[model samples]
Target: MSNTTVKRGEGILSRNRGVLVAFGIIGTWAISLIVLLLIDISQLAIGWRIAATIWQTFLYTGLFITAHDAMHGAIAPSNPKLNQRIGSFALLVYALFDYKKMMRTHWLHHQQPASEVDPDFHNGKFKNFFAWYGYFMFRYWSWVRLFGLMAIYNIISLVLKVPEVNLNWFWVAPAIASSLQLFFFGTYLPHREPEGGYVNENRAQSSNWSVFWSFVTCYHFGYHEEHHEQPNVPWWRLPELHQRKLNAD
Candidate 1:
C-alpha cells in the first residue's frame, strides 16, 4: 500500500509512464484490430495470417495486462477516477468485462490467493490444466458476455462489412488464445500447489525465466511472488524487482 502512494522512485512506476504505456497498448490493440479487419486476408499468404494472429493475440494479452496494472493503482495512483476509467476501457475492449466487478474479484485473489475464498482458486479438484481452465472460465463467464460478443460479431460482420473470416481469425481467435496465455503464465503455473507445499504467505510462485521470456510469456506476470509482495509495481517493473531479489539471494 505504501508503494501505491508514492511517485517515481527505484522500482516505482511513475504516473506518466503508466499512463503512456497503458494508452500505448490500448491504441495498438485498437489500431491493429481495425487494420486486420480492413485488410484482405484472402490476398495474404497463410504464413502472414498466422503471424498476424499471433501478434494480435499478444496485443490482446497486453490489453488485459494494462487493465491489471490499473487495478493496482499503478496507472494513475493519485487520480482514482482516471485509473478506473482507463481500466474500464481496457476491460471493455478486451471482452466486455465489468471493470469494477473484476477489481473486486482481483482484490479477493490477492487477499486470499489459492484459498476457497479466492475467486481465481480451483479448490484443488481441478488440477488438470483443461479442467482448471474450464473452471476459471466458468467462474468469470456471464450470459451477458456471451450475448454481447454475439451482438458485436454480428454488427462487425454485417453493418461494418467485415468478413466473417477476418472476425474469426483476427478478432475472436486471438482473444481466446490470449486468455489461455494469461491464465497459464499469470495464474495456473504460479498458484498451483507444489509437491513440497506452499512456500510463502502469497501462496504463489515465480518462474526462473529470463526477463525476455518473462515478458514474452505474460508481461513479466510470471514473476508472481514479486507481484504479491509489491502489488503496486506495474507489469513492466516486475523483472527489475525480480532480478534484484534474485541477486540478493
Candidate 2:
C-alpha cells in the first residue's frame, strides 16, 4: 500500500469505524442498565433484585471498557480533541481522574511493560501463598486510592456547604468499587503468570481464548503484544493487527 493509502486506513480504524463501534456498544450497555433499573424499581422479588444488582455491576464493567477505549483514542477516531471529549465523559461517568492525564500514563504502559514507568505494574512478589491469595481476593484496594482522591472533592463540597453535594456519593461509591474490580480482574490477574502456567513472550498471548475474552470484556485491550508493537493502531484494530503479525511470522 502507498503512504496515502496506509494513512487513510489508519484514519478509518482510528476515527470512523472504531468510534462508531465503541459508542454503539456503550449506548447499548447504557440502555440495558436503564431497563434493568426500571425493572428493579418495579419491586421485583428478592432473588430477582439480587440478580439485577449483579447485572448492574456487569454494566459497570462495560463502562470501564468504554473509558479504556477513550484512553487509547479509539472511541472517536484520531482527532485528539474528540478523543479527549469522549474520554472526559467516560471519566465523569466511571473514573475519578483527569482523562488526558490518565491517557498519558497509560501510553507509557504501552511503550514499556513491567518497567518502572509502567503505572500498571505491581512488582512485589507475595511472601507466601496466603499473601498471593489475599492480593487476588481483596482486589478492592486498587480503588482505595481513587476513592481517597474523590473524598477530597467531597470534603471540599461539604466544607463549602454545597447543596446536593451528598448526591455524588450515589455514583461515587459504586464507581470506586467497580473500578477496583476491573483493575483486579481485568488487568492484574491477567498480567500475572503463575508458577505452573505457560508464559508467552507476552503473557496476554498465552491463549487465544484469553485474548478473545479480553477483547470482548476489556474493550480489545487483551491484545497487549500488538498494542505494544504498534502503539498508533486503535484498539478496534489491535486484534486484526495481531492476527496479521502472527500470520507474517
Q: Positional deviation of 96 in candidate 2, in angstroms? A: 2.7
Candidate 1 error regions (>4 Å): 1-14
Instruction: Compute the lDDT for candidate 1.
Output: 0.93
Query: Compared with the true structure, what per-residue lDDT tens digits does model 2 show for residues 135-237?
Result: 5435324476567666865764567443332223223334545655565555555556567753554444422444567554554556666665665666667
lDDT of 1 by residue, 52-73 (tens): 9999999999999999999999
Worst 10 residues of 1 by lDDT: 6-15
The lDDT of model 2 is 0.58
All candidates' TM-scores? 0.94, 0.62
How many residue pairs clash (N, CA or C atoms closer than 3 angstroms) in each of the candidate models, in the order given? 0, 2
Winning candidate number (TM-score): 1
lDDT of each: 0.93, 0.58
